[model samples]
Target: MSESEKAARLSVFKTYKLFVGGKFPRSESGRVYEVTDSKGRWLANAPQSSRKDARDAVVAARKAFAGWSGATAYNRGQILYRVAEMLEGRRDQFVREVGDAEGLSKSKAGAVVDAAIDRWVWYAGWTDKIAQIVGGANPVAGPYFNLSSPEPTGVVAILAPQESSFLGLVSVVAPVIATGNTAVVVTSEASPLPALSLGEVLATSDLPGGVVNLLSGRTAEIATPLAAHQDVNAIDLAGAEEVLAKELEIAAADNLKRVRRPQPVDWAADPGTERLTSFLETKTVWHPAGGSGSSGAAY
Candidate 1:
């Protein structure tokens, strides 16, 4: 190596884009923000998504919901498992990003990455089995057969946890889609690289476009409209502060959206099916057990 002949070349920086509708697009507003590592080293410019972008994501999610929700549960499970597989293939990339974004030791970052992958796998298995566990035949006094089952509530907006970037992002996103709900996620404002990279994995994992859209920007800016939007079916405020969560919950009432308030959560802990159930709607059907069954169905 020389000065001119033994000189080190400048490193090439990566430009991170937003993941929407299975496509990598610059923010329609052409806005971007500097994303820095924990040490304040410049990493890249991430898309500073706008409200129009949020609306576009919601539109895409709503458009894709019927097909995704109607797909066989086994197929959905396979697609989710494929997300885990894709993440595994790109393990080192995530480890590096996690370490940089969260300022964790390599081992700690690796553990976070591992936990994220496992979280996807866990939710994958739940796709096909949730209906069975949350629903069943009801015993009635009348001669009627009654049964209940879970159904997706349609497009969901997720505010991903700000602290535990990778693990928290995975924990919030996986369960929403596991039970057939499509989502538009607002990633952590401070550390969104891993979540942005996750869009690449999801794009290749056979998940339908728009089934899961990820945005990187201010949470309140993006989450407010989603909470108030008449089209959105639910809003998960898992990552908001108490006051902000309360405000968004009240806004969600504008459209009667299913609202999930923030709870004390440890992303590393075992998360049961609560997340899955939060966005699900129960449907019950009743039918007379006897006679010709003409105009005899029970309400």
Candidate 2:
């Protein structure tokens, strides 16, 4: 074969890995699936991850929690913003990867990639401000003063949307982290490439280990344990399979885990600030009043 012919036919095997505790490794199952080109030609095999893999990611996120949630808001904001920079540097890769995974034309894929990166930057700006936005002072019905504020909901487990994998993943992760919640995200089962690539961007972007644990596997098998996991204070079902999403909602009821049901989003549609709402938790405080000189509700 001519050199050009040899190069043209050279098939690259895609090795998919799970990201946990800031490191990437093969799925414990040691299995992979054959991806295909638009014409249905073989591309490469990705990891056939398992429920065990999902559990492992959760453990990592749980372990990383105390430190990550404890991080200074400014520091967390800086790291979250750095993910956008990393995404920008990897734009070409995403353009190609998303095109292949979502079957989009190159230009369309690039546009989506650009939007996803921008979304991360948008959320990074929220890290320091989200708390102030969702929370405020309230008039007391009694002799005491009261204030309500937002707090992190502890470790969050997410099932990211599948269609617009990159941006959907960003939507889920950004809001969760904006309120100081660390997360364990399940890679889209049929399309896990962009999600894993995102993990690399996040890791290199100075995200603390376990701040975002990514597992590639069957979404249902993995997410069930998480919704029921007592330690997981919240579960973002924004990407759950139909039966699975319903099941998790029921399972979440067991522990009263704050469940966010999946909503079909038109990625091309403008997402208002409403996406920033769920991650917030209300903590209302009351203080005793003595003098009339006391503050006005004390924010």
Candidate 3:
């Protein structure tokens, strides 16, 4: 064989970076750790996000929260649905990632990917209707109109589940953004490649930058600062172990941050509105009953 035919082409490796402020950046500490498949075979090197990186993610999420929370629910739904569309288009790639990360067969991994995409679509459908389900008019025996509405809780920190990887990660993340809250997500410690890949999908979708920042590193190290961040409004400890969850919960109490403790969850099962509501706050308004000429007083 000739030299051209005999020489094999070198495979170009992908540089996995943290997704912060809608840009791909190496960790602030410039560290990376090998991400491996279920059988301990190296898949790639994922950015080892630092405390500074976590803080940066919070800054991004906080900066984006106003615009994201202010957007109309219908518009938010449209963006989330667009994410589902993008995920659907990249189904095969996720299937391979999930299969490698979770030690599943191609068909099983494909099923998980399908579930994740569908989960995104499901949350998309909830965006406009959650208010009606969770908020409404209250009967008051006074010359006043009382009503309550659900509002986003601002920046949320999420620990992506270790076992389920892609499916679990989507399950935790889609809901926070669906309800208008921005998120800083720490990917699975052992299996972060799929989560990093997910950042690429989110970047391409209509979802705004900083709406969902992705970080990969030691879960405990990344989560500690987030739990205590004064600017962070809430945290989900789905991926934290018992001891770590307890520690983080205590730290969250410093700022009275909303905490969702770690619980055994079936990632593939029907996820109800709990995750959606966990990071939402209710704002109740009491307006005096009035015509145009009446006093514009609110009690």
Candidate 4:
């Protein structure tokens, strides 16, 4: 064969973009940063998200909260399962990204990607069952029906873990949405491509627009405002450092955002119900019951 015939075709570069409200858009700031593979080879220019981008994501998540939270548990479970399906369909792409992002061998990256997909399936099963597990009836001295249930706390801000980028990101984000809370995720600063690509999967799944908005940029830059935003109902500082986590916690307190402090974890390990309950709020409801009076008033 001639030398020209033996040459490989040039690969088409993919432009990595931010995912917000189920659409891919360039950063509102009109800026981009070069992403590289583990060996320092050029990958693509990922969006450099801004503070306004963070705020916008919060708004999108807020708008999506009611519908998502109001959806039937069975329906939500199916939707989450659909995410797993989409992830499975795009397995090879994620395998490549994970391998490049985490500097793992192709085999190791495939394992990680497989784990992430299974994690989604795990959370999917929890949607219908969690409320029954965490909520129940209580006996009271008065003639009333007292019941408590876990409810979505509205929009949540998440800092995806820095290491184990894809699996960790899925671990954090899945539970939040599985329990009906919408999310604004700030992907790992060092390895954001996988997280950004996951957004594409979410959009293609049956999930509603604005349900899970993702941003890729400085973690603190995006997390700080989300912590303080009044509309935000919770914050997960999984990716923040000691000093930064402390600062974000303080900011979260301004509006009493339910904060999940950073803790070391094996993202590949079996995640129990804690993450599902972490972002949920228990609501106790009381209804008068059972007594008939001669005065024609019944309780």
Please write out the lDDT profile of model 2 over residues 1-299, one tens digit for every residue. 89989889966655767788899878788877766645666656666667677777778888888888789888988988888999999999988888888889999999999998888888888878866777877887776778888778888888888666787888778878867888888877777788888888888988888889888767777788888887788888888878888989998888788888887788666676676677667889998765455555533
What TM-score against the true fold does each predicted structure earn? 0.94, 0.89, 0.95, 0.95
Worst 10 residues of 1 by lDDT: 290-299
| CA error at residue 141 for candidate 3, angstroms | 1.5
How big is the positional error of residue 30 in model 2, measured in Å on the Cα after superposition?
A: 2.1
* Stretches of candidate 4 exceeding 4 Å from the true structure: 1-8, 295-299
Instruction: Look at candidate 2 and tell me the lDDT of residue 213.
Output: 84
> Candidate 4 local accuracy as lDDT?
0.92
lDDT of 1 by residue, 26-65 (tens): 8989998888899999888899898899999999999999
- Model 4 clash pairs are none
Tell me which of candidates 2 and 4 scores higher on lDDT. 4
Candidate 4 lDDT tens digits, 1-299: 67887686566788888999999988999988788787898777888898899989988998898899999999999999999999999999999999999899999999999999999999999999998999999899988899999999889999999987899999999999999999999998878999999989998998999999999988888888889899999999999999999999998898888999999998989999999999999999999887756765776
What lDDT does the true structure give each of the candidates? 0.93, 0.81, 0.94, 0.92
Worst 10 residues of 3 by lDDT: 290-299
- Please list all clashing residue pairs in model 3, or write none if there are none: none
For every model shown, the clashing-pair count is 3, 0, 0, 0
**CA shift of 8, model 3, Å:** 1.1
Q: Tell me which of candidates 3 and 4 scores higher on lDDT.
A: 3
Error of 3 at 20 (Å): 0.6
